[model samples]
Target: MTWNCGNLSSKLATEEEYKIYVDGSYLDGKIGYGLVVLKDDKVIDELSGYVSDPDAQDSRQVGGELVATKEAIRWCQSRGIKRVAIYYDLDNIKKWATGEYKTRKPLTQNFKEFIDSTNIKISWHKVKAHTGVKWNERADELAKAGANSQGATKKNGLVDDLEEKAKKFSDYLQRRGYSVNYKGIYNSQAAKLSLDDGFQDIGHLNIYNTKKLHLVPKYHELRDKSKQSELEELWQEFLG
Candidate 1:
């Protein structure tokens, strides 16, 4: 199976010796489901399947977990990772893999096949939900972001201006080898990242009453720190 765009990006962030976490939620006999991915407490990508299994009647039925795990496995395999740990709140999935349970649906079974198809060493851990863990918090953000993945609609007038400003800030971040995340709350609420000497807070630049301009990204390199100010200047000139 192929990955949704958000899943891929979320997986990429965890590349090369990073902790990876994946979460999925489904409702209504698996009619609507979404997945969230995280790396090192940062959101990489998320995806909600556009599945229309209308015949399903169980609204509480969760269908997206297996596919999400499949993508997670893909992420692990592609990186040639030999060992990793995953967290799942649901015990059935862990049990199924451990041969403790069985499901009639091929979803988790297919995931089992995918797991067997690979030689990587993986471990699953169960963590308490809503307990304020790092992985859980990050996963929550990713899942929520995925749920809103229809793409943010372009706003008009003032909203447009704020978005543009956010983009400009994000561009400035990218020029420094940092991935900009503009969808989170703007009051530094989502920033779990640390900036090197070359970075500046520049304060929150709000494009609207409800928005503050706290845009930060990971850019850490001793050699590159000096250029941070220069890029900031260019960003000002371009956005001015």
Candidate 2:
């Protein structure tokens, strides 16, 4: 089989086929992925790892998902297995592999090409996330653990300076009565920030390598129109 997208069937796979449950996690801006391989409903192997590639970092959890799936496929290939089923929480995993979604991003394009290069029979199944599905939940737990396992490496001067500025910006927003959350190091040079007004999210701020900042607003048009000027003022003040 090339690929099948939908819910898993009640029937179990044969002895020759393997079932792999995969999940990706993004924690504090670190991306990680986990996978559990099963044969006849018994665990055969488990894999988890942190993704450090800059391209994967930009894709976040989706990057982890694709990595997990690809790793699982490689594992099967190494063992001479030709048929496998992949269970995943994200729809994009299936969409990208099946050509249902365009692979505009570099990470996605690479993922699609990797899948095309493989000769194994792969089937994709969507599993509802955080619903306590046994293998699926295990994959999620492993993914989180992998994300937490990212090593503490020393940063360069530019990164250090950018992190300091991001912290100051967060503190400034908090002093102004807005809730500020930091997403740690987004990459080697940037960090992600989230802004909220107690009950609703205002937008995300990206602190870049050049010390420039950009806001991605999530506020509703009509309801947040009055607050636009205030946000602009905050941005100016932060830059100033």
The candidate maximizing lDDT is: 2
- Per-model TM-score, in order, reads 0.45, 0.60
Consecutive 10-residue window with the lowest summed lDDT within model 1: 188-197
Residue by residue across 108-216, what tens digits does model 1's lDDT show? 5544545554445556656676688776555545544443432342233334344435544543454444433334234423322222222443232223323453333
Best TM-score among the predictions, by candidate number = 2
Q: What is the lDDT of residue 128 in candidate 1?
A: 74
lDDT of 2 by residue, 1-240 (tens): 276545433342343368999999999999888999998888989988776656888877998898799778767755768888889999888889989999998888867766775657887778899998999999998888878866632336566556656655665666566655666566666666666676776666666764454333223432445666786678678888
* Model 2 clash tally, residue pairs: 0
